[model samples]
Target: MESDLSTSDYLDQIERLPTHEREGQLFWKLRIRETRSQLRHLFANSRLRTSLVISLSIVFWIGLFVLFYLGFDFVVGQVGLPGATYHAQTVQFVFTLFFMSLQIMLIFSSGIILYGGLYASNETNHLLTLPIRDSRIVLYRFQESLFFSSWGFFLLASPMLIAYGIVVSAPWYYYAYLPGLMISFAYIPCTIGAIICLILISRVPHLRRIVVGIIALLIVVVAYTSIWRTLDIKDADLLGAAWFKQTFRRFEFTREEWLPSTWLSNGLLEAAREETFDPGDLPWFESGKYLIVLLSNAMFFHVILLWVGGLLYRSSYYGLNSRQARQTHLRMAWIDRITEKLLWLLPRETQLLIIKDFRMFRRDPVQWSQFLIFFGLLMLYFANIDRFRQHRQDINVLAWVNIVSFLNLAVVGLILSTFTTRFIYPLISLEGRRFWILGRLPIERDAILWGKFLFAASGSWLPCAILVVSSDIMLRVSIQVIVIHQFICLMLCIGLSGMAVGLGAIMPDFREQSPSKIAAGFGGTLNLVLSAIFILLTVLLTALPCHFYFMANESKLQTQMIPAGNLLLWLSLGLIGVVLLTALVTIVPLMGGFRAFRKLEV
Candidate 1:
C-alpha cells in the first residue's frame, strides 16, 4: 500500500511539472532561441552600422568633449582654493540649478511619453500573446523605453555637462557621469512602475477611460513645475558662504542645502581646486563623495530592476489585458442616432480611415496635447504684434502686408505639419495586413491616393484660409495686396498639403509605433523642406518689395516709367518666386511619392 501511494505521488508531481521542464522542454527552448534570433535580425536591419563614419564621428565628438572638459576643469580648479580670485559661486549655483532643471524636465517628459503612449498601448497586448516569458517581454519593452528616454536626456544635457566638466578639470572617474546614464536607467523603471500601478488602479469600473490621459497630463505638469523650480535662481548672489553661516545659526535649513547634486558639484569644485593631481588632496576620493553617489545609484538601480522584473511586469500585463473591459454603452436617443448617422456620410472606407485616425489620436493624448500646447503658445506669442511695431515709425504698406503674409505662412506650416504624421503619413501604413486587398479591388491606386490627398489637404487648409482672412481683417491691409497674398497663401497651402501627403505616402512606415514617431522618421524632413521653401520665398517677397518701396520713397519719380517698371519688377519677382517655389513643393514630392508608393509591396 505504501509503495503504491509513493508511485502515485511521484506521477502527480511529474504531471504538474512546468511545460519547459516536461516533454516539451526542447521545443520551448528552441522557440526562445528562434525569438531571440528574429529580434537580433530586426535590430541589425534597423541599425545603420556605419563603422568608419561611427568611429570618426565618435572620435570627433570625444575630442571636442575632452577639449571643453579641460578648459572648464582649469577654471573651476582655480576657484576651489580659499581666497580664490573668482567670486563666481553664484554663477556656479545658477548653472547647477539650470542643469538640474533641464534634467528634471527631460525625466518628467520622458515619463509621460513612455507611461501613457508606449507602455499602455495595444503593443503590450500583442507582446503578451507571444510565447516569450512575461519578464523577458517587460525587460525588452523597458529597454526600448530607456533607449529613447536616455537619448533625449543625452541630447539635452551633454553639452552643458561637457562645459562643466572642462571648467572643473574633473577626474578620470568623473567621465562615468555621462549626463543621464546612471539616474535615467534607475528612475525610468520607477516611472514605469508608477505608470503600471496607475494603469492597474485606473482599470476600476469608473476610471479606465480618461485615466491614462489625466495621469499623463498630471505627470507632464509636475515635470514642468519641477524643472521650472530647479532653475528659479532668484537673488542667488546674496546667498553666499558667509550668509549661509549666519543663516545656519538661526535656522535648521543648512543641512538640506547640500543636496546630492550639490555634493557632486562641490566635489568637482574641490577636485579642480587642487593645483596638482595629488591623491591626498583630490576631494572626490578624499571626501568619499563619489562612493556615496555610486552606492546610492547602485541601490536605486537594483531596487527598480527587481520591482520591474516582478511587480511592475505582472501589473502591466494584467492591467493591459483588462484596461477597457467594460465599454460604456451610453444611452442614445433619436437625435444622437441621427447625428451619429449623419457623421457617417463619407464612404465606409473613408469613414473607417478617419475614425481610426481620430480614435488613435484621442486614445494617445500626449502627442495631440503637444500640438495643442504649441498652438496655444504660438497664438499667445503673436496675438499682440504691437510690441514688434511699437518704436519703428515710417513702416511701409508692404511691411504690414508682409507681416500678415508671414503669419499666414507660419500658420499653414504649423497646422499642416501637425497632421503630416497623424493623418498624412499613416494613410497608407494604417492599411496594415489589408494592403494586399488593393490588388484585388477594382479601384485604381490613384483613386485611393487622391482620396487621402483630398482628405489631408482640405482638412489642413480650412483653418489656414480662415487664419489668412482673419489676419487680413485685423491688420487692415489693402484689399489688393491681401487678395494677392491670399492667392499666394492658397497656392503654398496646396503645395504644402501635397508635400505632406506625398512624403508621408512615399516614406510610409507600415510598422509605425505612433504618429509622432512616424513624424520623427519622415514627416519632420518633409516639413523642413516645406518650411525652407516658404521662408526663402517670404524673404525674397518682403526684401525685394521693401527695396523697391525704399527706392521709390527716396526718388521723386513716382510717375516715371523707370520707377514704375522697377516696382513692377519687384512685384513680378515676388510672384515669380512664389510660383516657382510652390511648383517645386507640389510637383517634386508628388511625383517622387507616386513612384515610391507604386513600388511599395505593402
Candidate 2:
C-alpha cells in the first residue's frame, strides 16, 4: 500500500505541490470524509432499509432459481441428452459464446456506468475540498460504484448457472461451484472499473462513449453468433471431419487465449464428467483449463485495480474539478430562425414543453444508446424473418410478416412512450412550488394536458412511427402490407402516447422525479402492463385474420372459414379497434390526466 501510494505521488507529480495546492489537498480530504459520512448516514437512515429489501429480493430470486432448477432437472432427466454418446456440441458452442458475451457485456456496461458522470457533479466539486489522500478517495468511491454494479451482474448470471447445474446434474464435488462462479463474476466490476479509470486518466475523454459503444456492440455480436447456428457462417462450410476437429479445438488454444466463459463451461463439463473423463483419453480435461482461466480473470482484475490506484485517482479528480467550455453564441441561421418562428405558432407554454423534452433528450446518453439497441433488435428480427421464409410454403408470407412487423412496431411504440415519459413525467413535478403559480394562472387543466400530450406525441410516438416506417421500407416489405402495418402502428403510437400522458398525470411525484425511480415506480409499471395488454389484444385480433388467410391459402380455397360473415366480423373487429384506439389514445388518458391534476398538490 505504501509503495503504491509513493508510486502514485511520483507518477501524478503531486509532491511538487504549491502552497495553494497543499491547502486544496487538505480541502479535498475533508470533502472525502464528508462524502463517506453522507454514505454512512444514508445507510443508517430508517427510511432507507436497503439491507432488508435486498435480503428479501435475494430470497425471491433464489425461489426463481429453485423453480428453474427443478424444471431443467426434469427435462434433462426425461430427455437423457447428457449421456456420453449424446453430443450437443453445437449447443455447447453456442452456450459458450453466449456466456462469454454476457460476461463481456456486464464488464462493459459497468465500465460505462463507472466512467459516466456518476460523481462528476457539483457535489463532487465540494467533496474535492477535503483532506484525504486522493488515491484513497478514488479507491473508496470505485468500490462503492462496484457495490452498486455487482448486484445487477450477479442477478443476471446466477440463475443461468443454477439452471445449467440442474440440467448437468453433476455430483457432490460440484459444490466447488460457488468459488468458480465468484471468480467468473469478478471481471465484470473489475474490468469496468479499470476501463473507466483508464479512460479518465487519458485526457482524450471524448473517445469514452465510442469505446463503450464498441465494446457493447462486440459483446452483442458475439452473443448473437454464439446463440444462432446460422450466425456461425464460417463453420457452415466445414465438412464432417473438419466439424469434429472444430468441436475439439480447445486443445489447440492456450489457457490465456480461452475466454472465461469457455473455461467456466469446460470446468462445468469436466466436473460433470469427473466420473468418466480418463486422463489418457482427454488430456484437455485433466489440464485444469477452468482453474487457470478463473485465476487469470481474478489476477487481471487486481492489475486493473492497481492501475486505478495509480493513474486514475488524480486524473479523475482534476477532470471533475475543471469547468467545461460553454457556448458563447445564441445565434441562429435564417432557416433555424424560420423554424423557431413556425414553432412559435404553438402557445408559449406548449413550445416550452417541446423545447424542454428535446433538451432533456439531447442531454442524455442513455436515451441515445436506445437507438443502437433498437437497431440491433431490428437486425435480429430481419434475420429471423428470413429464417422463417425458408419454412413458408403456400403461405402469403407477406400477411404473416405484417402481423409480426406491426407487433414489433407496437413494442417500439410502447418503449417510446416509456422513454419519453422519463422526461415529461417529472416536468409537472419539477415545477415544485411553482405549481401554485400555474394553478393561480388562467390556464385550464385540459389545456395543460393537451400541451403535454402534443409535445410527447411529436417527440416520442411520432418519431417511433417514422422509424418503424423507415425500417419497414428498408426491409423491402410489400407496399400493401406496409400501408396497413403503418396504419396499425400509427394507431398504436397514439394509444401508447395517450397512455403515458394519462399515467404521468395520474401518478405525478415531484419528490421522486429521477428517471430511474420513475421507471421502477408503480405508475410506470402499471402503464407498461396496460400497454402490453392492449398490444396483446391487438395481436390476437390481427393474428386471427392472418391465420384465416394462411389456412384458406393452404387449403386451396376449398372450405374457407373466412367467408362473408367472417370478413364482416374482421371489419367489425377493425372498427372496434378504431374505437378502442380512440379510447386508449384520447379518452382514458384525458380522464386520467384530469383526475391526476385535480388531485395534484399545489
Instruction: Name the top lDDT candidate.
Output: 2
TM-score on alpha carbons, each prediction: 0.58, 0.66
Off by over 4 Å in 1: 1-136, 149-302, 305-309, 312-364, 384-423, 436-442, 462-496, 511-568
Number of backbone collisions per candidate, in order?
9, 13
Q: Summarize candidate 1's per-residue lDDT along 451-484 as a digit string, tens digits.
A: 5665565555555566555565545555665666
Give the lDDT of residue 398 in candidate 2.
55
Worst 10 residues of 2 by lDDT: 230-239
Model 2 CA lDDT for position 194: 53
- Cα deviation of 350, candidate 1, in Å: 6.0
**lDDT by residue (tens digit), candidate 2, 189-220:** 45655555555545545554565467557745
